[model samples]
Target: MNITVHRPGDLTSADRAAWTALQSKAHLNGSPDLANPFLSPEFALATGQWRRGVRIAVAYEGGEPAAFFPFQRSATGVGRAIGLGVSDCQGLVHGPGFAWDARQLLRACGLVVWEFDHLVGGQGPFETGASGSFPSPVMDIDQGYDAYLGHLRERSPKFTRTTLAKDRRLARDHGAVRYVHDERDPEVLAILMGWKSAQYRRTGRSDRFAHPWISQLVRRLFHTRSDSFAGILSVLYVADVPVAAHFGLRSERVLACWFPAYDPAFSRYSPGLVLHLRMAEA
Candidate 1:
């Protein structure tokens, strides 16, 4: 096996195609998380454009791309999953039968160790290194909204009904409700960043948006439109006023839920939940 490392910006067209194909093959092996846009080549390219340390490692067997591992390499020989903080799901993309040792891959890229917090399932190499694992909830809408609603109703009837009631109340009290699944307005995205920053500050947490790169990454991503990775800004407005928003990335199939915030004044109305439900419906 040959382990080749390329800065995401340096990847050629054929290299990108190989990387993308690996992502698809990995996703089809019975796991939905592998299909996430955050794991797509477009996302790596976008991130590499904004961040300098991003790299993609493609392992080849007999001159065919068999696996792809994306990470950020620090000068100190340490590496972390690409877009570690912002990427909701993270992992190596590989063919169904390909096998590569994580330590060997790290060495080829001149890294001592690689770390991950949100590593997706099917990552065999880092499983032993995982100190703890937690479930990240996903709302599967492929079967359609009504089917998802049925599952929710069966699992948690009260929460499902309450969320639905909030949606109804929001529409009744505030004029017509408008749900935009993909809002192209830059202004809307800016407002969402501001709201999320305020949320962080009010909660006595370090505001991630305070970092210029994080903010810029979000802005650029909002403008990115592609099949593998497109920024999805789901908005909920009542009476023509913005109440809640969630900015996430989506591939053809999965939505990698990301930064979600709502107007504090509308907290009682639970516009956040309302936005998500409407988003899922869309």
Candidate 2:
């Protein structure tokens, strides 16, 4: 096998095709937490100008594409998995029989240390190279939505009952219960941003909303579609008023949950939790 490093924006069409093909075959190989659209050549190119230290490494075996690694390098001779904080899954996308050295790959990428958190299990190259684990909760939205809610009720009985009761009371007083599944509404994104920003301020945390790229990336991703991931925006309403919203990505088998927020005025309704339950149902 031969390895080659390509700048983030320099992946060719052939490389893109090969990378995506491997992604399809190894659906469960990487982290399951967050979807990295950065793995997409088009998305890489689209956000290249704003993404510092981005790089791609493509590996070939017998002159055939075998694996792809996306990473970012910092000035301190260290590299990190690209989209680290947001991507639930992190690691190289590779073919089944491919063999490569993770240390060599990082060295070739011009880094002394390569760090990753939330790495998907079975990343052979990084298996022995320093790693740890953490819990990431996932709802199986596959058995259709109802079955998923049933599981949630079993696992989180108190949370489920409380959220459901709040939702029922909200509907009774508000006069109607309405929900928009997979809503492609830009307005919903705006509301989520506002709530998220306020939450950050109230908690005395640095606001991600201050970064325009973060906001733009979320909006851009909401409209992006591919076999590996689908941009899904959903909103819940009470009496025609928007109360809760969530934005996320779903591959056929996994939903990468992201930003979620609800109108503070409806905090008594616990709309955000209810929206997730409804989403799990759908």
Candidate 3:
């Protein structure tokens, strides 16, 4: 096996194809953490805006691409997983039964310590170092919308009742309720950014919207579509205007939920929570 390091923004079309091929073979799941979007070439390119230390490690065996590691080198000779804070999964994307020396890769990338928080299970080289587990609640939406709602009712009776009542009240007082499940509307993305920014400010949190690159990345990702990490944007509408919206990634069966926000005008009605219920049904 041979390994080579490529500087940020140096990957060619062929390198991208090889990386994508390796990712496809890994059979990524929808947790947004393990899915390929954050690990995709496009994402790495965008992440260069925030993290200027990005690099790609491509390993080849018999002249065929076997594994691809997307990582960032810090000033302290440490390598952190790419998209460290924002990405749900942090690990190597590789072909079946692929194996490599983690220390060697780190050294090649000029790093001493490699750290990752959300490393996916079954990452051959780094699996042993994963220290803890993080719980991500998921609702299966495979059996059609009604069936999912039934599952929700059975699993979370109180939550279901309260949310349904809220929905009813929202419709009665505000206007008729309308939902645009899996809506690809750009307006919804804009609305979500506005609400998310407001939430950050009202709560005294750092505003992600204050960063131009982060904002640009979100907007760019909202429009990106590919097999590995296609953006799935869904919205809940009232009188033809989006009141609630969600942005996530759909990789196979898993739908990794990311940003979700609702119109503050409808906050009393809890439109955001209502939108989640509808999303689980979709």
Candidate 4:
């Protein structure tokens, strides 16, 4: 296999189309997680706008695209997934049955260590490099919202009751609640970032939004709209005031929840949970 590295923006229309096709095929026939918008070429393109080191390694066989690896690198030879901090899915999107040596790929990309947290399943090339593994929660909502809710209620009746009761009380006390699945307002997006930043500080976690690049990247991603990759900014409002909001990436098959936050003033109401439930129901 011949490997060629290029900036994400350098990809030609044909290259981008092939990458999307390969990802879609893999999502249908291999791991369902490949359907995540974070794994799409569009996402890499958007991230590349704000990130300097974003590159795509395309492996070719017989002068045709075989696989695509999108990542960002540091001057110290360290590599990470493109949009690492905010991206929920990681790893290369390849054609079916395609395989390559992980170390070979890393060397080809001039990286000594490639770090990834949410590596998708069915990756054999990188299995040996994995030091530990943990389950990433995924909700199977293929059965529609009501069916999934019933399944949840069956599994955790008390939890479901409490969550629903809180949602009802929230709505009652703060006027009727409204949920916008794909909110386009830029101000709401800013509000989400602010809330997320405040939540990070409150929990004593490193605030990702503190970085100007991350903030710029998210704002650019909000305007990215396509069939395969679109920014989904969902907001929950009470009495016409935004109480909770979530900014996530979505494809036709999967909604990969990314950043979520709520007003601390409504902590007792669990507005975050209500927002997520409404997102699922929508």
Q: Quantify all predictions' global Cα lDDT against the true fold.
A: 0.84, 0.74, 0.75, 0.88
* lDDT ranking, high to low: 4, 1, 3, 2
Q: Which stretches of model 2 miss by more than 4 angstroms?
A: 27-47, 127-131
In model 4, the worst 10-residue window by lDDT is 23-32
- Model 3 segments more than 4 A misplaced: 25-36, 127-131, 182-187
Instruction: For model 3, give the RMSD to the true fold.
Output: 3.1
lDDT of 4 by residue, 204-273 (tens): 9999999998888888889988777788999999988999999988877888889999999999998888
Better of 1 and 3 by TM-score: 1
Candidate 3, position 4, lDDT: 84
Of the candidates shown, which would achieve the greatest lDDT relative to the real structure?
A: 4
Off by over 4 Å in 4: none
- So what's the TM-score on candidate 2? 0.87
State residue 244's C-alpha deviation in candidate 2, in Å. Answer: 1.2
Error of 2 at 57 (Å): 0.6
Count of residue pairs whose backbone atoms collide, per candidate? 0, 4, 2, 0
